[model samples]
Target: MTDKSETAQPSGLPYAMSAYLIWGFVPVYFKLLSHVSPVAVVAQRVLWSIPLLLVIMAFRKQLGEYAAIFRHKAHLRNLLASATLVAINWLIYIWAVSTDHILAASLGYYLNPLVNVLLGRLFLGERLRPLQMVAVAVAAIGVAILIGDALDTLWVSISLALSFGLYGLIRKITPVGSVPGLATETTLLAPLALGAVLYFAQVGGGGFGDDVTTSGLLILAGAVTAIPLLMFATAARRMSYTSLGFVQYTAPSIAFLLGVFVYGEPLSTTKLACFILIWASIAIFCADAIKSYRASKA
Candidate 1:
C-alpha cells in the first residue's frame, strides 16, 4: 500500500515542483500545435517520447529494469493499464488546449488532488480527517455548481482528474523505478504510435515535417512528454501520495492564470464561482494536511 502520511519528502519537493511547473505551462506547447489534430499530436508525443526515454534509460543503466517490467506479468499488466489511462489523459488535455477549453482543463487539474485523496481512501485504506471531509464536500459542491451551469466542459475537467489520479495511483503501486517504468510504458505504446503516424502520413493529416518550426516542435514532444513524467514518478515514490497531490496545485494554478490572462479563455461567472469554492476547498485540504503531518510528528 502507499504511505498514508501527508508529509512530503524533502527530496521529492524538487521533482514535484519541476513536474508540475512543466505541466502547468504545457498548454502553451500544445496550443502552438493547435493546427494539428489532437490524435496526431498525441501520436507524435508517443513516437517522439520513445527514443528520448530509451536514451535516458541507457544513461541511467535502467534498460535492464525497463525490460524486466515486461517479463513480470503482474507489473506489466499494471503498467499497461497506467499507460492507457495516461494516454487518455494526454489526448483529452491536448484536445482541450487545441479547442480553447484551457480553463476547463485547468479546472480538471485543480480537482485532481482531491481525486487522489479519494482514491487513496478507497484503495490505499487512508483515513480522512474532519477537515479533509469538509474539503471533499466543498470541492464536490463546486463541481456540482459547474455541472449545473457549465455542463459542456465538466467532462473535460472530470476526465482529466480521474484518468490522471488513477495513473498516479498505479505508478505508486507498480514497484518500478521512474525512468524504467515510463520507458516501459512508452515502449508499450510505441506500436500504436507508429500506426497512428503512418495513418496520418497516408491521410496527409499530421503536422510533422510540415515546416522547420512545426517539425521541430513535434520532435520536441518527446522531451516534453518524458521529462516531467519521469520527475513526477520520482516524486510519487519519495513522498506520500496525498502530499504529492497537493504539490500538483502549482501546475493548475499556473495554467488557470494562463487561461484567464494569457490564453484569454472566457471564464463565465459560474466557472469563476466554482474556482473560488475549489480554492477554498484546497485551503481547507492543505490545512488538514498540515495538521495531520504535525500530529504524526508529535
Candidate 2:
C-alpha cells in the first residue's frame, strides 16, 4: 500500500475519472434492484463486499498489512467510526435512488465537495481561500433554496453530504491503506449485514434466491461497491487533492442527467435555479484550485 501523503503527478487523472464515472452511473445499477427493500439491499451490499475486498487484498499481497492493522486498537476504533458513517451514507443513497429521489441524491453528491472544504476548515484548521469560502456560501444558498421550497427530501441530500464528508475526513487522518481499511470496515459491518439478510429471509423479504437476476445483481453489489473506491483510493494517493476534488463532480453530474432524462424526474424552476447556483460555485472553486496548483508548481 502506498503512503497517503505521497503525491504522484498527472498520471492519476484517468483513474480518478473512471472511478467517478462509474459512481455517476451507479444509480442505474441500484435501480435494477429497486424491487428489494432499500435496507435489505444495503445489507446485501455490505455482506457481499467482504469477500471481494478480501480477494483484492490477497491478490495484492497486502493481506499481511491488513492483518497488522488489527494489532492497533486505535486504528480499529477509527475504522469502526468510518464504517458506521459510510453505512449511513450508503443507506440514504440507496433509498434515494430506489424511491425516485434521484435528484436529491445527485444534489447530495454535488454538495459533498463543498462540505469537504467546510469540514477541512472547521476541523483540520485549514483556511479556505476567498473563492472557496464564497463557494461554500453559494452552496448553502442553493440548499436553503431547496429548503425554502419545502423539499422535505433535503435531509437526504444534507445527510449524504455530511456523512460522506466526515467519512473522507476520517479516512484522511487514518494511516491505514484504503483497501485494507475498507475491508476492515466491511468486516466489522458483516455481522449486522448478515443478521439483516437472515432476518429478511425468515420474513420472506430477502431478494436472494428468489430469481437468478436479482440474486446476481445483489451479489454484484460487492464489486460495484469496492471497485470504484479502490480506484478512488489509488487516484487519491497518486494525485493532488485539489485535482481529485475537481474530478469528483463527474459522478454527480452524471446522476443529475440521469435524474432529469432517464428517470423522468421533474425539474421545477426552483431546482433549476439551485442547480445553476451550485454549478457557478463549483466553477469558482475549480478556478481557485487551478490557480493555486499552478502557483505551487511555480
TM-score of each: 0.95, 0.94
Q: Output the lDDT of residue 167, model 2.
A: 84
For residues 149-218, write the lDDT of model 2, one tens digit per residue. 7478899999998998888777777777779988888888999999999999999767999999999999
Model 2's TM-score against the true structure: 0.94
Best by TM-score: 1
Considering summed lDDT, which 10 consecutive residues are worst modelled in model 2?
1-10
lDDT of each: 0.89, 0.85
- Model 1 misplacement above 4 A: 1-10
The runs of at least 3 residues in candidate 2 whose Cα sits more than 4 Å from the true structure, single-residue gaps closed, are 1-12, 237-242
